[model samples]
Structure formats: structure tokens, C-alpha cells
Target chain A: MEKNQILSVAISGLLALGLAGTANAADNKPEMEKCFGIAKAGMNDCSGSKSSHSCAGQASKNNDPMDFVAVPKGTCNKIANGSLTDGGGVVKKAM
Target chain B: MPASKYTFPCVAGIGLRAPHYREVLETLPELGWVEVHSENFFGGGAPLHTLRKVREHYPVSLHGVGMGLASATPLDEKHLSDLSQLCNDIQPVAVSEHLCWNAATGFVINDLLPFPYTREALDHVTRRVTQVQEKLKRQLLVENLSSYISFSQSEMTEGDFLAELTQRSGCGILFDVENLYVNVRNLGVDAEAFIKTIPADAVKEYHLAGFSERDGCLVDTHNHPVYNEVWDLYEHVLKHLGPRPTLIEWDTDIPALPELLNEAAKAQLIIEQCHD
Candidate 1:
């Protein structure tokens, strides 16, 4: 079927159901840990309070310098090279 | 999302952010309403799915951060179309955008920049807002912007600009009280003059957010809780314009959901006081 037809059918089906399915099963998110030195540009959580750019979004580094990543709790130390801290700005980027 | 017949209630709500999405969806706390940035759920991805689920529970408001309504360049058609699609899927109770510009002839500024409130700008913004409303098929709420710089070439004040924008475009106003406070501190804009100039009836909603101070400049960072002085100003605004659908927005460095609700409770108390 064409795109518009498919959309119409889906919307019609949804409206016909008169309140779609019940809200998805509760998000039961896992206990995640922040693994330093892995996050790509514009994708990681806050760098840290000490950093100038402390809100959401990863820092854009002029170099390949790692920024940190969030993995499930208790797995950061196991990564090839993941620490809990910024290692004295070695991984942090210039704001 | 159910085809909502409900209008925005005259109560306080929270700007729903990503960090608390699961908690909000699962627990469905005692929130008056929820306002989400319209750009986040544009392409029917996980965000849109989450928003659809949210729409089932709350009267969501589609607040656009990237509309660039008053930009000197032509309005971004793709952005407008994406917003219109989101509206169709969510059917928000109210839709709002900032009264500022982001795009220019060559490059686009990511932040909301204040413009000179000139007659030419008035006509330009009016036409663009009209275009947006025609596409969305509903009234758009244009929120006043927080400014760091002011144009010396401006003919009138920001309040006058907003008042004129509403009249010329047939749009409602989403008066962000915190933005007004920032302007008053940074630019010496008279709060009383602003409060008196804008038509009270044109105001459809009120945005209450927190700001951070950097080098003596009050920035609308939305990372802190509503401050005491801003709350005082909100009281003044409510007394003048009466209570509207107020929202507590904490965009950056967002705290826990309870913290947000606590702020909303404060606004709710003030709204009740003004109503009484």
C-alpha cells in the first residue's frame, strides 16, 4: 500500500479502537552508571558540575578525546578504558 | 491520544522533560497539564511514541523552541510542517512559540535573540504567525522572550511589540513571567509598563521558569527552581492579568519530579490566592 493509504488505515484503525491499547508496560529502566571516557559528540549526559557545559548534551572535542558514557551500574571499570572521573580533564573537551 | 475536548484548565502544570518521562508516564502524578517541546517528537520516533502515551493522560501543550517566527529570513517550511504533524498526532490543548528570531540570511543562531520592535518587524512577524496558525488550524500562543541585548533602533517596548503582534496576527500570548523578570534586570525594562500595555484577554497561558546568574546577567537557563523575586513578580502579573494556564519549566539540570511538582504547587497557591 502507498504511504498515505497506510497512514490513513493506521489512523483509522487507531481511532476505531477508540483509545488505542493501554499505555505500554511501565518503563522499568535499568540501573545505569556513568562510565567516563566514551560518549560521542552531542549524545552523553551532563559532563559534571565542575565543567562549564554541565547540562545535557556531550561536549564537542576538536580531538578524539573520550567524554564518558553511561553503562549499566557496576560495568564501567570493566570497559577497555573507562574510569569514574574525568581523569583531570584528560577526557573533557574545551567549552 | 484520545481526541481531547478539554481546554487548558486554569491551574499550574510542569514542562515535561525526557529524564522524568518514565516516572511521569508510570505514576501519572497530580499535574495540571504537561507542556513538551514540539521539536522533540517530530519524526514519530520513540519520543513521539512516548508523547502519544503522554497525550492519553494529560492535556499536553506543544511549545516550539525552533519556530523562529520573527526571523528576518523566510519561515522554515519544513519545521512548520513538522510541528503541524506533531499537532495532528498529539492534538495539544494549546500551542506556543517564542516571540524571537533564530534564523537570518546566512546562518541561524541556536539561541532565542531579541529583535528591534519596529513596524517592519511587526508586519513580518504578523504574516509569519498568521501562516503558522493557518497551517495548524488553531490559535498560536506567542511567548515573550528573555533578552541579553536590546536594540537601540526599536520603536516600542517588548510588551508593546507582543501586544501589537497579537492584535495584528489574531494570536494569543503565552506570557513568560520569568523572561520578563530577566529583561527587567538585564535591560531596565519597566515591568509595570509591560503589564499594563498588553491586553489581558490576549494572554492564553503563563510560563514560569528559573534562571541562572552569570557575570551579573540573569540567564533564562531553566536549570534552577523559581526564585523568590520572580515569584513576587508573578504575583503582580496574576493580580493584573488574572490566573491563566501557568507552567513551571525546568529544562536544563532538571531535578526530580517531586521538585518540579513542588514548584508547581507554589504557583498553584499563588494562582488560588489571586483568584480568591
Candidate 2:
């Protein structure tokens, strides 16, 4: 093959591999949903709700409907007898 | 209900926190068992995966910090279910919660708070404990609280309250020696009297943690090493209650794995001496 053609083919192969890698990365991202009103004080996943404390086990109040933890994407609302807030729960708020 | 299949060894364990998870799992240190804050593993994924791995090498005890057993909010069912699921998953050697309230009418304080030791409160706590025991289908060890405040309407000492709760609810006691010391220092509780009041067999586990003094009040911070005074108190407890599964808990400002193991070694020495 011509040198330029060979170079173009190699670049195209690398570009295709890069795109496939990106798609695989996207596929690897686990589907997660935010479970709210279940975290005990100071036990929330992160500082998504309160202002006073910015770390785990630092929630200012218990069952702060605003504080949440990430669960499997669709399992939050399906938790039997689980408590959650509006807007499809805190996951959307967090996003 | 059948008793929990798991039994903790009468040796020294450590509170398994995040910072030490990797090293503890990798090195498999010479420890009795490890306890994790149940809430930390409630959501699943990496935390639960690590716990599963840790479970393979160690007998894990699910120490819950968020059950709010004394809360007046009718016990969060989801919370109980989540804990039940965790219990089924981990099958820990023991499960325990504090003898304090964290939620009340309309608000929940994340910190453990002292409640009035009234007959009404007793009834409330007993029912809640029974409910928890029913859900877990195993005896729950209730730990005494280290409080900074006391209610004016308290009708009984914390020790008496715990003893009665055990008798009425069929639960076990997780005697936290440091918490007793903190109460003695901050609330003027008589440590010896507290020890004498509790029934010995009821104490299935013991927690030894460090405390700090803030404005002359002792705080169960679990940051520093177990203090001399607390160790002295633990010796007294060992004499009365005999050796139990003692755990060295360090939550905040967590030290390296060796430092925690060293603390655990000290507890192991004390426990062995008691056994001898």
C-alpha cells in the first residue's frame, strides 16, 4: 500500500478504537439512584442537603429527606415502605 | 425466634473504618474480628463489596449508629428492612445500637441524645427494642450512651434503665466502658454503681474507645488512644462482667492500621489476663 494510505488507515483504526473505548466507558458507568430520607444523621453519602457538615456521619438531622445515598438507579423508589421526596427523589436534585 | 447463628470470640476486635479497610483486608492483621458501622454499608456497591471480602477473613459485627431505637417516630421501616437485609447478607457475629434517642417530634438529631428515664420512656424503648429484636430475629445488644446533658425528669439511673430494658425486651447489653466513664465524668454517674446494676450475662460485647475533654465534659470522640482512666474502668468491668468480645473503636482522625492493632493488642492482653 502507499505510505499515505497506510498512515490514514492506521489513524482511522486508532480513531475507531478510541470511540469504542469511550462507548465502553459509558457502558461501564453503573446506573445509580439517590435514596433519600433513609440516611441517619452524619451517615449520608455526601453533603448534598445540609450546610453545617460536609462529610459522612455529619448529617445534622436524622431522616433529612434532603440527604441521600446512591443506590441502583431504579431501586430507590421501589424500596418497600421506603420514604422519598419529590422530583423522582434526590437523585435528580443531586444531578 | 432462633438465636443469631453468629457468636463473637472473647477476643479484642477493632471498629473497621474506611481508611483501614484496604490494609486490614490485604494484611489480614492478627485481630479477633472487625465491626463496621451498619449504615456505612446500607447502600451497597464498593462498601458492601469490601465488607463481603472482610467477612471472608473476619467475623464481622454490624454496629449500627442510626437505628434510632428510642425515637418516637414509629421506627423507620425502611431503615429496619435495610438493616434486616444487611443482617441476612453479612450474618454478623453480633448487632448493636445505642440506648439513646436521635429522633423526636418532627426532627432528628444525628448525635446520640439522652432521654428522660421515665416509666413512659421505658415503655417506649422496650417496645422499640422488642420490635427491633423481632425484625432482626435475633437479640440486639444495646449500648449505653455517653451524654453531655441529663433530663430533669429522669426517674432512674442509666444503668438501671439498661438492666430493665434487657429484662423486659430480651435484648443483650454491649457495655461500652468508655461511655460509662464519659457519663461518670460528665454526668457525675457513679461508675461502680453503674457496673453493679447491670446483669453480667446480659453483656455480650464491650466497646473501648478514647474520649476528649471539651469544657470539662468528656466526649466519646474515639479519636485518641484509650485513656488510662477508661482502661481502669474496663478492668473493673472485666472483674464484674468477665471477658467479652472487646472492640477498639477509632472513628475520627483514624490512625494507621498498626496503631489500631497495637491498641487491640493491649485489649487482648487485658482480656487474656482476665480469662486466666
Best by TM-score: 1
TM-score, B chain alone, candidates in order: 0.97, 0.97
The alpha-carbon lDDT assigned to residue B162 of candidate 2 equals 96
lDDT of 1 by residue, B155-228 (tens): 99989989988888899999999989999999999999999998999999998888887778887888788899
Q: Tell me chain A's TM-score in each of the predictions.
A: 0.22, 0.23
Q: Candidate 2: what lDDT?
A: 0.80
lDDT of 2 by residue, A14-95 (tens): 7887778764466575533222222224554522222221012221223545556655566556665344444344253343
Clashing pairs in 2: A42-A57, A42-A58, A42-A59
lDDT of 2 at B152: 93
Question: How many steric clashes does model 1 contain?
Answer: 3
Q: What would the per-residue lDDT of candidate 1 be over residues A1-95, giving only the tens digit for each residue?
A: 99999999998876656555443233344232222211223554523222222111221224564678645566565665354353543454533
Candidate 2 regions exceeding 4 Å error are A1-95, B1-5
